[model samples]
Target: MAKVSISLDAELVVEVMVLAGVGSPQDAIEAVVRDYIARGHRTEARTELKDEALRELDAKPQEPQG
Candidate 1:
């Protein structure tokens, strides 16, 4: 993967490192970003499934009750 350089506050980096249980700043930030992306993908898939189910339900005809 290509590498890029960016500056961040020391305190914030340390906080991420601790929360991520990573020894290095780079690892901590990368882990957090990867997790964030994975969560977004999962949410999208769930929403799509829900929308499909709703569309299917709307397309079906309802039966009359006596």
Candidate 2:
């Protein structure tokens, strides 16, 4: 993978490091990013399941009216 250089606020980096419990700023940021991506994937999967269930309900035959 290619590496890129960027500047970030020192305070923000320290906060992230503390929250992530990682000694290195790079590892802290990376951990947060990976967690965010995983959360997004889980949310998307749940949405897909809900959509599929709705479609199935729509496709089911209804009882005739009295």
Candidate 3:
């Protein structure tokens, strides 16, 4: 674990700690960061899949039926 110090909003940190139900500021911050990363991954995957689907739709030839 790396020890570094940065300033944050005191009120926000307190709110996060209360919401996360964690006693320490470090734990609350870690949880928030982890959630943010996971959400980004999910969003990226969703966008990739959507792009692939659009490309596939454009590539497929439409059949004409009488």
Task: Give the Cα lDDT of each candidate.
Answer: 0.98, 0.95, 0.95
Q: Note the clash tally of each candidate.
A: 0, 0, 0
Per-residue lDDT of candidate 1, residues 1-66 (tens digit): 889999999999999999999999999999999999999999999999999999999999989879
What does candidate 2's lDDT look like per residue over 17-36, in tens digits? 99999999999988998999
Higher TM-score: candidate 1 or 3? Answer: 1
Candidate 3 matches the true fold with a TM-score of 0.81
- Identify the runs in model 2 with alpha carbons over 4 angstroms from their true place: none
Return the TM-score for candidate 2, rounded to 2 decimals.
Answer: 0.87
| Model 3 C-alpha lDDT per residue in residues 16-51, reported as the tens digit of each score | 999999999989998998999999999999999999
Model 3 CA lDDT for position 59 = 95
Q: Name every residue pair that clashes in candidate 3.
A: none
Give TM per candidate: 0.86, 0.87, 0.81
- What are the RMSD figures for all models against the true structure? 2.1, 1.3, 2.6
Ranking by lDDT: 1, 3, 2
Top candidate (lDDT): 1
Tell me how far the alpha carbon of residue 12 in candidate 1 is from the true structure, in angstroms, after superposition: 0.4
